[model samples]
Target: MSSIAEQDLADRRARAIQQLLHTPLLHRDTPSFDTIATSEQWLKEWFLRTCGWILIVDYRRGMARLRKVTGWIDSTHPQRSLRTGKSTFTIRKYVTFCLTAAALGEHGRSRISLQDIAVAVSDLSVRAKVSPFTDLDHKDRQALVDVLMLLSALRVVTELDRTGRDYSVDPTGNVLYEIDERRLGQLLVAPLPPARCSTWQQMAADPHPQPSSGAPLDAHRLRQHLMRRLLDQPLCYLSDLPDDDAAAVSDHTEHITQWLSEAGLALEIRADAWMVVNRRAGTARSLRDGSNVSNCALLVLPQLTAQPSGWISATHLATLVDELLDEYPWWARSLRNDRNRADAVATVLRSFDLIRPQSDGWRIMPAAWRWAARVDPACLPPSSSPIPTQPAQDDLFSVEPTHQ
Candidate 1:
């Protein structure tokens, strides 16, 4: 291929990889469908080779799914609501989701009304000895509606009702839906059917299960597991991995780094952790987004890095936030309260694995040093001297890819 054609192909492949990472299930109507569909073959091979993920593309039906598997379950990322501030799914919502899916699978006809689905789900819930869906309860009704909306988003079901009103608004409203049986069948990416597994651990079992104690390690599977964590998680810590896997990472650092680079990601390796940074805008959340929580987290970083022992007591952290609040009067009004602001900052930092809770307090992780702010002489507090210099890097909190 010509240089121009080769560049275009590379760009398309990168974009497709990113799209699947952000949204694993891509429907025909999604804006990136054409790009992903065109690069289907490359994506399949690339994902399988790099992360052991399966990429399924259906051209005629217009859908693509990246069946992702990981050695560990990530509770941080959950199936969230598409509406109402995009809240994470609650226990009720999860139960309702499973019940609804079961009901849909059992329904003989492709067309069903919202009311009928509720009745079917309730029946199933009762038979399964779980909490039955109460149609009269607003919370119960809303949870069911949320599940249906999620299914619609996945293209497993299409709402036929054109009414502008939401089903959540009226529990008795009959919303018609046309189910796509094929898409629904493809929704579950489990290695085996739920009926065959009694526990969730069994359901999510790896096809080529990890070897028992003292057994020889499978180098290829180890690489796949490591790559999967790098691609799917915010950060991969050496301490979190088994000794064998950690050693593998050190032994094959160069190979793994090259693998990430080919996918348009920069591998940022610290002494204790690895972070895959995507230069593409909007690929992931950045600390510089100027949101209240993110801004606070950035401000809190200096305090975290300043600690000599790499640990900060919760009380001390709150005091730091209070001082910052007084210094930066222009901060969001919502953060006026010291405790709330401190909690928000800590939560955001923890989400990025920059700081982790310890029995004593919060331990500033090695990755936290990457975002250490440069102390300005003009803004230095009267009692506090400049923080000790940190190891140099190209940028501060920049998601832009950089060579190590």
Candidate 2:
């Protein structure tokens, strides 16, 4: 094959993997079809080897799904709003989302008008004894529309005429949509049916049986799995692995780097850490640090690193966050007075494996020290000596975002 041809093939493969990591689900209407169609098979095998499961590609429906399975615990991240800053959602919104889904399922028709959906949603909410939107203000109705827009984005309901915003403005009738039944089912990608588990705690527990210690470990397979994870995830900690696997990964750092290079990815290896620096194949990254929660994480990272024992309790961390909020009230106004600040921060930390909840409190992970190093004064440009006081409108989770 020509050199250019090989590079093109490699670029396509990298894009496929990147999309799978970034998007919770991929549908045909989106531009990701190119990657999903050309590289589906390769992605399926790669995910199976790395994550212990395969991708679900519904060719007839034009969908590619990836079920995020972590240690058999089935708590996926909350469905965040694409437009909302830090994607905040109230419990009412959550309940409304489920009720709307049930309403759609019971509607039985492929097409429904927005007015009809509103009536259905109102009826469902009343049946559940939740607050009715019969007397909703502009903001409250917008929240309901946000949930519907999220569903539209996921291809659960195809807007036939009017947009979600229009529905929010006046949900009396007019907006039409066609329901994608398969896509609705795709939204919940749990490994087991809800009937099998009763409580959230039971669902959170590892469902798989532990492997026997006497079973033979395939050295090559172990190395392959480690390499795939190093490339796929933001970071892989030794503390999360078995002793033998951890030792094997640490010993084969050089081989892993070489393998990454062959696949056109740059690697950064440390004593107790490894990460992908860049992709030479020019594929876009999936993990981005541009949310309000992420900004909070960055602001508090230096304080966490300065601790003598390199550990801090969740209570202390929350106190630190309170201090930061007081110092910069306009920074993340969404979280400043919000009661869920701790939960939001914990969610961000858990996503990056930056902290662990122990008997005493949360333990800072080694990989998070990189954030501290990044904030060093020496790393700043001469013109930008001090952190700017005037927050940019483009700042992630900014109080007044320039873009809606």
Candidate 3:
């Protein structure tokens, strides 16, 4: 192929991979479905080879799914609401989601009424001895509606009457839905059937288990595990990984970098860590956004980097936040009196692996140096220096090596 043609193919494949990473479940209505469908073969081979993830593209069903599994349980990414603001699913909503799925799976019709599904869900909950759903309780009714909305988003069900919201408000109100049984069946992607698995560990077990002794023949497994960590996490610390996996990373750094580059991700290698930086947008989370939490995190970056020992006490961070609130009067007004603002900022920072929770407080990670504000010596006062001003742009994953 010509250079131009090869570049175009690479870009198309990269876009498809990014879309799958952001939203693992893709349906006919998804904007990037055409690119994903066209490059299905490449995507399948790439995901399987790189991360051992399964990529299923059903052209007949007009949907695609990437079954991704990580070495550890990741609580950072959660099934969020489809509405504006995108609130994370709560425990109640999660329970309702499973019950609703079971109800739909057991129903014997292609078309079912919203009220019927609710009744079925309540029945299943009672039989399972879980919290029974009651229309009398507004919270229960809302949770059911949320689950339906989520299903609708996944294209498992189509709300024919568009009155699903009404059921949440009024117990008597109902809506009709057309169920897609095939899509419903594809929802669960576990290594073992959930029925046979008694514990979460069993459910998440890898079917192709790697040898514990790290034999040369099983080197591919180590590579897959390492790639999965680099792609799925914000940062892959050598200390956080198993000894075998960490050794594999150090031994085959160039090979891993080439694999990531094919998917339009840059592999950032550090003495103690590695991180995959997306070349394109929409593939990863943004920490420089205009949200209150992001802004707070940015404001506190300087304080974290200024610590001589890289460790700061929780009480000290809270006091810093109070002083910041007073210094920047125009900052997030809602957090002005919120005592938990410090904790919220810490959570945001921790999500990016910029800081880690220590026994005493939080310790700033090496990766945080990329976003830390630098003080200007020329403008420093004789007695004390003001809070350092942040750079004009906080480019994600663009940083200099902290160590030689």
Candidate 4:
């Protein structure tokens, strides 16, 4: 290929990678960043090579699916609450999703109405010795509708007449939908059926269940997996690697660094974890958001930095949140659920490796110092100062949290 052609192909691949990383899952009916990426063999191969994610392209169904096998705490996306306007997904919503998926599989229909779905879900849930859908309170009913909307967003179901969000307000409200059974079947990317599994722990055990020595490590595939992790996570720890992968990484360190540098990223090697550092990368959230959760996380950062032991109890964290709410009543007065606020803050912190949940409590990770001086400088007291210039008593980066 000519230089110009090569550049064009590189640009297209870059855009496609960005799309998959951000959205992860794609459906036939939804608007995708690049429709061509799904159909093109090269793009499909790229995803497989890089992430170990299986991109199933069912052209007949107009569906392109990425079956995720690894990475992150929440493999299945937890959507925002439509009725309550929260980022966190509640238990009610989770139960509703289970009911919905079960109902759809049992229906065996081309098209179905919302009321019909509700009835089907209720029957299925009751049969499974789970909560009956009919017994749902107004909030639970709304949650059911919310999960339906999420399904619609993924194009598993198409809204024909009234919107899914509309049904959240009025359960009795009539809405029409056309179910895409093929796409719905692809929604759950599991190796085994739920009936065979004893616990949720079995889900992530080994996505590819085969004899350990069946196949040798495909060098190209391994490289792609590393690249995918570099792009997907803030930090990839060496300790997290399987034996074969660790050997591959050790053998090809220089080559891997070259690949990352070519892709506009620099590798930061530490004792435990490796970071794909990009100084110019943009983040979704700013520190200035008036939301109580964001403010709480900001307030907690300084105290977290000042901790001598590098760990704080959940009780202490909640107390710190309470102090913040007391000081900034105007900021958090509208926030009703104190527990949810702390959970949300922790979620945000964990994403950036600022704090990790431990057996005792949440441990302050070394990467958290990046925000020590950056967040609410005027608001924090002098005693809870930023990380000291000199080397700390403990080597922060020397240790990695074994807890998930």
Candidate 5:
């Protein structure tokens, strides 16, 4: 690209970002540097908690991206291990694409279709660049299906959504298996797929967490309401806040702003005061005016809970995560009882408004861990009293909660 063209693209991106920020209040125009630092730190910690040590690290960015690695034994596994280019940072080569495509399909974190891999790798010879078989153009899908078969045979992965609902047709006239993610960790060597948690179910079971609806309307109640409100959209401004809201936030505005800012929610700086909104709606909110905060807040749940403004703070967050971890021991595989681990967990909990920080400890926010427990009773520790219902009301990643 020419320098002028590159500059134009950069300028366009800058304009787009500025426009995105415009959706925030004037005071919320920019994040305080502390929040930025906290977010970056939290992202890194989140990856490490799940990936262990082999994650891709960016020292400059202080972050890492994880790759799923499957470990299966076969007469072929040994052979491939001995041979050149058996595994890679990516799914590789043309001839090997039969296996490669399946690995990408079933195990890939990114939602790459078989054809997405085939087109990108067709011309290259390296493990990183080889394409799937493309003869007769449409026949490549059998190769992908064959690859999944190989994976199944090798125990690298298994197919889920067995109704065969997620298949994509390969160019070669064959229908390929859409790789299932639930049991993907069964394919890996050391690290495993992070277990998905059901927030609603857990909340439903928690003695500490109150009802999903109807509350004394304390800080916790406020957070629960906020999370529920976000089901419809991103944020709610304080000035325009509902009077009937029993769930008010921290009495102090500055601390509340800092806490939400540290967590995933951000405050838009307006001419008068800052504002807060759900981060997922960050993209949408970025495009609209601050007037949309209420709508967005109302949009996020019962799909996902929103953190009330009352519960905010990096320090308090650390403790809340510790408590949640204590309550849910199954995820203990991912949690270590160390300080950094605590810090990382706190940051994410903070993002979701599950907790707020005090000078020395975390204060559990209005959100409930029982939600996940209620949704997935199997998640409770074996010794604990059995929950009466299935906790998994919906898939973790899908938009099922929206329909709720």
Candidate 6:
């Protein structure tokens, strides 16, 4: 081999050695079956959660921890996992995510639940539009539980408590399982840095100030702010962002999209506006009125129009008014007549990159206008805020933002 190739191999070996030695689960061989493999996977998952990523464990990118503790692996020869199974023969993705999130200690208590997992999984399977759902039986549920129990036997996780959910009427209701995270940190203390794309630097090309970790607010708004920041362009979307983060929009959008059809939103590729229809529960008026769904519609709608083609005339476009009215009939009745309402909504839409104007009418941006809108409205220079008349200052802080 070339010297460079040899050196590269040696470097990888050294790093792998460092990873094993530094991580809590050091190389230690032991006898384990399917249950054992499940347990190890749980432990590794927990390690990930403790470090700040919530990943579901079931059928995903096909990662399986085939064996724990391969013995005497060295540069010359790689160690092979002793035990192999024909099928993956392990826990589902949802259970793994719960295990890992629970392993993050108290920080994860709110989100880790059987209902959450089921909803998340069902939603993912549904949104992905890939299931008949009739085939899974009680045996399937038990089999999943058995895998978790196996994880416990392998000393991968400790069960803190268990509670039954009553679905007594028919098939199944709900079940809650609780897990402990005391051991996950053994693997988490010195985790490696995330992949290059997962960094904040990747999102913010502008050197705008970062939010303090302690920033206070509602989770969704925070997520919206982040969505605006990270997803500034056409190709950028939450699916393109991290699934785990304090930002509410990213997390909630990802969470809901898994259950709600990506089709549920009324975003047509042609229109720059986003519309939401009732997936469930609308008042007789709402079915016709479309308001409560409207608030949510407004909240989520701006997200759809990422790339606006041109200027939109509010006078010409009564559709926004009608849609808003349908979503919030009561509020719409009151707000429609407000003098500055159209301009206000238009400005906000512009900030959100939802709308633009063409030669004649309003146009929608197919890609998100989110990134350009990342700056908080409060951060906008005031009317009284002097424009830097000086050419250099004006040039430096120009309204035109580079896509970088």
Cα-based lDDT for every prediction: 0.76, 0.65, 0.77, 0.64, 0.37, 0.35
TM-score of every model? 0.84, 0.66, 0.84, 0.72, 0.24, 0.22
List runs of model 2 lying over 4 Å from the truth: 28-32, 57-62, 72-77, 90-92, 118-143, 162-174, 192-208, 212-233, 242-277, 280-300, 312-350, 356-362, 375-404
What's the lDDT for residue 174 in model 3? 88
Model 6 Cα lDDT, one tens digit per residue, 1-404? 99998665434332332232222232224212222234445534432322222222222321222112211111211111123211233324334334433333434653254445444544444544544122145544443444445445434444554455532222344445544343333322112322434653453332222345644445543433332332122122333333444333423545333222221211111112222222322111121223332332243234333214334455634455455444444444444665555544444444434455556555654433432332222222234433211111112121332110
Candidate 5: regions farther than 4 A off: 1-209, 217-233, 237-247, 250-252, 260-285, 288-404
Judged by whole-model lDDT over C-alpha atoms, candidate 6 comes out at 0.35
In terms of TM-score, which candidate is stronger, 2 or 4?
4
Give lDDT for model 5.
0.37
Ranking by lDDT: 3, 1, 2, 4, 5, 6
Name the runs in model 1 displaced over 4 angstroms.
162-169, 193-201, 313-326, 333-344, 373-404
Off by over 4 Å in 4: 1-5, 27-32, 57-63, 71-77, 162-171, 192-232, 240-248, 254-266, 277-302, 319-340, 370-404
Where model 3 places Cα greater than 4 Å from the true spot, the runs are 83-86, 162-165, 193-201, 208-217, 313-315, 331-343, 359-361, 373-404
Question: What would the C-alpha RMSD of candidate 1 be, to one decimal place?
Answer: 4.8
TM-score of 2: 0.66
Error of 2 at 366 (Å): 1.0
Cα displacement (angstroms), candidate 5, residue 322, comes to 55
Per-residue error (Å), model 4, residue 349: 0.5
Ten-residue region with minimum lDDT total, candidate 6: 262-271
* Better-scoring candidate (lDDT), 2 or 3: 3
Backbone N/Cα/C clashes per model? 0, 0, 0, 1, 75, 29
Residue-level lDDT tens digits of model 2 in 1-404 = 99999887876676666666667588777566676777778777766655555588887888888876554331325667655646667777787788788888889999987667777888988887888755246655667677788898888998878654464566453568899988887676554556688865565554553357734246655655566466446577665667766667756666666655544566665556565655343443422345566677666776776666768888898888787666665567777768979768777776666677776677777766654445432222244234422221122111221110
Deviation from native of the Cα of residue 292 in model 5, angstroms: 19
When summed lDDT is taken over every stretch of 10 residues in candidate 5, the lowest stretch is 70-79
Winner by lDDT:
3
**Every model: Cα RMSD to truth:** 4.8, 8.7, 5.1, 6.1, 22.6, 22.1
For model 2, the run of ten residues with the poorest summed lDDT: 395-404
Candidate 6 stretches greater than 4 Å from native: 1-107, 110-113, 124-136, 150-157, 163-176, 181-195, 198-404
